[model samples]
Target chain A: MERPAYRARVERILEHSADTRSLFLRTVTGRMPFYSPGMFISVKIPLPEELRIRPYTIATSPEDGEPFELIFNLVPNGRGAAWMFERKVGDLLDFTGPFGAFTLERAPDRETVFIAEGTAVAPIRPMLRRALSQPCSHSVHFIYAAAKPERLLYRAEFESLAVTNSRFRFEPLIVQGKELYESLSDEVARRWVHGDGERRRDFFLCGIGSGVLKLRDLLRGAGYERRAIHYERW
Target chain B: MARIRVIYENGSPERTIEFDPAAAPFQHDGQPGSVLDVLLGHGIHLEHACGGNCACTTCHVIVKQGINSLSEATEQEEDMLDRAPGLTPTSRLGCQAVIEDADADIVIVVPRYTINQVSESR
Candidate 1:
């Protein structure tokens, strides 16, 4: 069952914000490969010297097949981002995977908290979808933090889910002006992360390397066990 | 193609196996087929929370023997090892440790405990 490399074609591209875009890729085989939430795929883009492989988290759920989705922010000097930006519809792409251990744990009947920063929301989106679809009694709290309100991806989708799903709550933290550090600190304090009675809580974090690590330290200091904190950082 | 001998020391009733490089990039369980892939291919379920993508350190193993036979650790791998629980000079991520020497065999020691809650649950 070794995951094999597949040829995919770019089906469409949608601009989510000023700098964020979502690429939809459909396998040339006319079928979607098996993948789980939080898992990522390594896309191979040809460069002058050699092929550059970049890992991108699958944005849409597994059931949303055919054209798999990947959301990314345009990094100024990133080779992958630059190549991706130049891709047009029907362009061929080579990739391998459906890898990573960032999938949701089968912990039913417990509180689940997801803290996503910017495009880190890609992995958390599928997990939230799975959580809502399952027959679990767990409550979910998703806090999305972005540098600015415009940088927040999937804000409307999460907000709509919160309105319809009683067990779900969505909060957006926009760090504008001088309120960057204080906002995150205050929001974490306000959230009831601890579970009641014998039930346990799980926290999933995704974001840039430093931010994810900082939040992990903060959560650890807040009496959360190391095992309960799951993270994926880029 | 190289030859790799794997010793599973910490599983239920220890076991050992050999891997042929020709059969390498061994596909099992829909993984990318690394040492973690080879081990899991034979029913040895190591804790690989990152699905052998080297994103996490859960699949770390100590190369008790044949360290020189493996590929050199990348800077990213070294950085991740800093986060792993046990500190050993020979420690390597199972997913990233690819056997490169044809004449050498490898012996691996799976850590007694891994801290990934999701993998532990699985």
Candidate 2:
């Protein structure tokens, strides 16, 4: 990964929810590397008295170089998210090059399965956008998992994608909130059904800590080899 | 005087150090200034994902012992805690947690998630 030359400048801050906020960082120059839509970037912020780095998925398309967008859900009592919420309209954030390799395949594309929980939807949405724009040869299945309906994001947008392709499948699994650790485990078991795995499909998962773990275990048990699985955990 | 013991993630033995109690309390200001300053002062190499600010949680740590003795978690510290994996009651933003007392002994456990996630992502 080459060093990212152009840093992202905060163009505006939009609060999607009480805790979640989207920081729109517009590229000052057109020279930034063209990022894979589904990839994520590292953010460096200056706290009132300190410096911190956090990673968030690139939510906007690369075509929107007018302003690159990164999305983050504040962990109720998180450090980076909290400090990030304090960002003003004109702060500059340091980011390395687009690092994760979670982009859509360039070859004979097989089925695509995207599993998202909580704020994990941010990264997956970009991939979905890519799939929708160019129309890949293979089918795409987008699964969104959250603790409850109230917590799910981009539902309307993803549902719209389904309209574009009947072959596209969208499964929204709502995990009961609270006792969150156990709820996540149960949610994964429910989403990772037997037939769903081992098929010729590429799986992508994002979400909270436990959700990622549950997804990992489910994939490992469902006959999917580890090498085939590509993922990024925030 | 307050005493503190730091154990690195690399299989190194713990080192004991003392500080003057008259100095400011061990409170992290949620910025890149102090914790990194102190660690760098002690010649300890700590990783800051965003150079010490609250942008990332790469500096996450478990307050295995003496957490109660440290300063309270401010809104900034709590915010950064949100994205960290392996959430626990003992977790604190290492970048935010500071050692005030020169005589206080605290132990912190650095989880594999902090190092692992950043490495894999990069």
Candidate 3:
């Protein structure tokens, strides 16, 4: 497989939230390779003691304008993630592969439901746009659970999408008191028609491992087929 | 030690290699020197990313023959694979994985996902 060769430089870095940074890279060669919306890129960073290759999910569409975008969360101890959080604006990085199979395939089901937390929003953002682009036969909704409002990454973007697209329903769940989340799980579930006679719901569950389990259980109990509940857990 | 076979895509054919069962599993787990030790001794440059420390998928090879011959996935390796995109059931970390087989040959393919890069993407 021959990949497009290009020189990559960090064009823009947005401190969207306290913990997350959106690094926009401009491909100087201008050969924008095509990629699936939910795919990922493997970034190869050469260091002295250890070389690093960290795969981060693509946050934008097959965006081919000035800056190719990549939004990543900084894991506390992860080597590459820590380094990226410390990278300068004009720094250069090598990369390979927009590879992955975790993506949204359109189903005949009329209602679309998505659930994610934290950086999990990266892969699903494009699909959210596609779902809310027009008045489709389906009703698309999303549930986002986060540590708090402070750590929420795309507050403005999601809010705007929810406002403009009437078909979209977005719920940003913040961890309050001892209740991490699932505190609003019932409220989130009430929006869907997931009773006994209703057809199975398609759930795109993205997050860390534990949250994905909760999503799986809730969807499974409501008569959704196991296969219908797709997940891309971190 | 285990036996490993790397099949090059668009190359002459397949090549068979053997590692010492008594020696340590791939250098990353704190083994010494090169993964190319046996291969280089016999003249084979199995493309390894990062020299060989459970980093990067560049040297990725699909285990076409005997995946069971390799060591089990370490925690570090498994976490790395979680983000490796286009992951498959037969996929093994070539750098972290070492041979433990004596009777059979472990076959591998270089998956296309290892090479392609999006010029502009997420």
Candidate 4:
């Protein structure tokens, strides 16, 4: 079936950094369809000439209930970002989905590693939460990378989760002077590689196109199963 | 029913399948009766990173024949198509290009490499 477009009202906007913001949206009419962590929603922006559609990852967990959230960076000259920037509290917007197949495992069957850069952490956050909530013996790790400290979205939230959850570990990779790929390789080696062979691992990576590609290649080169490494890139 | 021929980039032999637009919505990934729908419904692997929302270009496919039989590309689809690798005059996002003429045969070429290789994890 074609995904139905649902109307939602912007309830609030939380400024995360100079370039990043989170929009909390509540369904205005019909109920928002059930969604998992990695699924995203495509927003409808009606320009004078034509309608423009852009998809944004839902940042909040389904376990959190109503007013699901979307985290995004304001791209210069980006039509979708511009339209989103123009939205205000109580303004209604039309969207479709809760779509995409980048969802998490039905049950925690192995150690989970979430690697993200910049606003890509939006989807990883909910996935991390859901992974932690389930009763599993394996540990979960999150390696978040950004060019600067300010760009590490949801740092506090992740840190808090790491502290409260015994099985969770959070690491921040700041790519200032080093190559992102090299730094990621070093980090992945230190955290995951050279580890116990008995531990089966699954990786979820999201970021700019190049970074995600590099990380995925690094993992695949290390002998991880192709299906074990799941990713989404923009 | 129409015959749909799919050409692969990895030197795999081309294959054709019967597609009936009336048996639309074979899956929920893209527009009903779309080339993506028909191909994926028949077990063809097409990478759709944005769940066929026209948000990503991983599903890019070149129309080799019967382009006129497919729906015209929308402005949003055109914008995304601009970023696809190995783009051509006939390039179209498989998810957005619905099969409008059921009886007319269609042919599409799947590129060797997409911008994103790791498709969605089911």
DockQ of candidate 2 against the true complex: 0.12
Of 1 and 4, the candidate ahead on lDDT is: 4
Interface RMSD of each: 7.2, 8.1, 6.8, 8.6
**Candidate 1, CAPRI quality class derived from DockQ:** incorrect
As for lDDT, the candidate ahead, 2 or 4, is 4
Q: Candidate 1 regions off by >4 Å? A: A1-3, A105-107, A179-182, A192-199, B1-62, B65-90, B94-122
- Per-residue lDDT of model 1, residues A42-93, tens digit only: 7877888655556788999887886889899889787778888888899998
lDDT of 3 by residue, A99-152 (tens): 554665343256778877778888788667655555676667788877778667
State how far residue A204 of model 3 sits from its true place (Å).
Answer: 1.6
Q: State the C-alpha RMSD over the true interface residues for candidate 2, after superposing those residues.
A: 8.1
Q: Write the candidate numbers in order of decreasing TM-score.
A: 3, 4, 1, 2
Per-model TM-score versus the true fold: 0.68, 0.62, 0.71, 0.69
- All candidates: CA RMSD in angstroms? 9.3, 9.4, 6.3, 11.0
Could you tell me how far off, in angstroms, the CA of residue B76 lies in candidate 1 after the best superposition?
Answer: 11
Q: Highest TM-score, which number?
A: 3
TM-score of chain B of each: 0.79, 0.72, 0.66, 0.91
lDDT of 3 at B64: 74
Q: For model 4, how does the per-residue alpha-carbon lDDT over A158-205 read when each residue is reduced to its tens digit?
A: 999989888898999899889776788788866566654433689988
Write model 2 residue lDDT over B1-122, tens digit each, in one string: 65556665556666655555455433333333234445544556555544454435666777778887666776445645755777689887766666564456677766656532544454
Q: How do all the candidates rank in terms of DockQ, highest first? A: 3, 1, 2, 4
Query: For model 2, how does the per-residue alpha-carbon lDDT over A1-234 read when each residue is reduced to its tens digit?
Result: 223445667898877778777888876644556566666676665667655555667887776675777778767667877777878898776765554445553422676677777777777877776666655677777767767686778788777778867878887877664655465456445655543444465677665544565666566567666644555544
Model 4 chain A poorest 10 in a row by lDDT: A190-199
